[model samples]
Target: MSTPDIVLTRIDNRLVHGQVGVVWTSAIGANLLLVANDAAAKDELQQELMTATAETAGVGIRFWTLDKTISTIHKASARQHIFLVVKTPADVLTLVKGGVPITEVNVGNMHYSDGKEQISKKVYMDQADKDAINGLIDAGVKVYIKDVPEDKEQVLQKF
Candidate 1:
């Protein structure tokens, strides 16, 4: 099975916003935006909104559950350059554990919430998030914190 080119795997709490739909999509040259989140896969309204955003950006979009993303991501044609976005590090871990070939992850916006520690300007993490990120690092994935394409990449380590 041949997998699509995963141009960027990003974790952003606000899934498909202006930065993602416009900036990241154009910057990465991704033909498809693959959203791997359980909540998003089942939410019709969210799907519609994100789909419209992708279309406006001149890209195709797919909302798939983590399991679906794992099983069928390889089915995409080689010409499909995919930008995979999820809400959390845990979801990225799930995709990695499920055998999706993710070697690098861009930490975008992990919102500040109760019980979460600020890791970067736009990123926060609790114990679970830390653990998931550590697991990814242990698995040989290069995890970095960067909100936008133009920003300098901060390698996340020992946080």
Candidate 2:
């Protein structure tokens, strides 16, 4: 198989914010931001907001559900540079289960919610989140927690 064009896979709840829209996009030189999120794919307002943010960074973006994302993996891989973003570890698990070749995943932000443990400044994990991360690691996908390109990477282990 040929090498996939997707250069980065990130699990960021704030899918296309200032950090991802500008810093990460420019840092990785990724021309495309493929947001694999079911909710975002159906929400017009959220889609518009993300698109506007991506435009500010001069990066193209497309939103798709887990199934659609898997189906279009071939075409997305043909693009020059793709920065894949998903909302949760569960989403990443879905993609991996669907045969997406994600060698690594960066956990940007999970947010501090009720019944969740603080894993990092920008990442919080509930039992389900922890389970999903473990599943990905077992699948041989390296997962790390980092807010930005400048932040030190924390390996997403059992926690």
Query: Which runs of model 1 end up more than 4 angstroms from their true locations?
Result: none
Residues 1-159, candidate 1, lDDT per residue (tens digit)?
886699999999999988999899999999999999999999999999998899989999999999999999989898899999999999999999999999999999999999999888899999999999999999899999989999999998844
Model 1 / residue 19 / CA error / Å: 0.4
Query: Model 2 off-target regions past 4 Å?
Result: 1-3, 77-79
Candidate 2, 1-159: lDDT as tens digits: 455688899999888898998999999999999999999999999999999989999989999999998877766446569899999999999999998889999999899989999988878999999999999999999999888898888997775
State which candidate has the highest TM-score.
1
* Superposition TM-score, candidate 2 onto the true structure: 0.95
Query: In model 1, what is the error at residue 41, expressed in angstroms?
Result: 0.3
**Cα-based TM-score, every candidate:** 0.98, 0.95
| lDDT measured at residue 143 in model 1 versus the true structure, 0 to 100 | 98
Clash number for each model: 0, 0
Score each candidate by Cα lDDT: 0.94, 0.90
C-alpha-based local distance difference test score of model 2: 0.90
Error of 1 at 46 (Å): 0.8
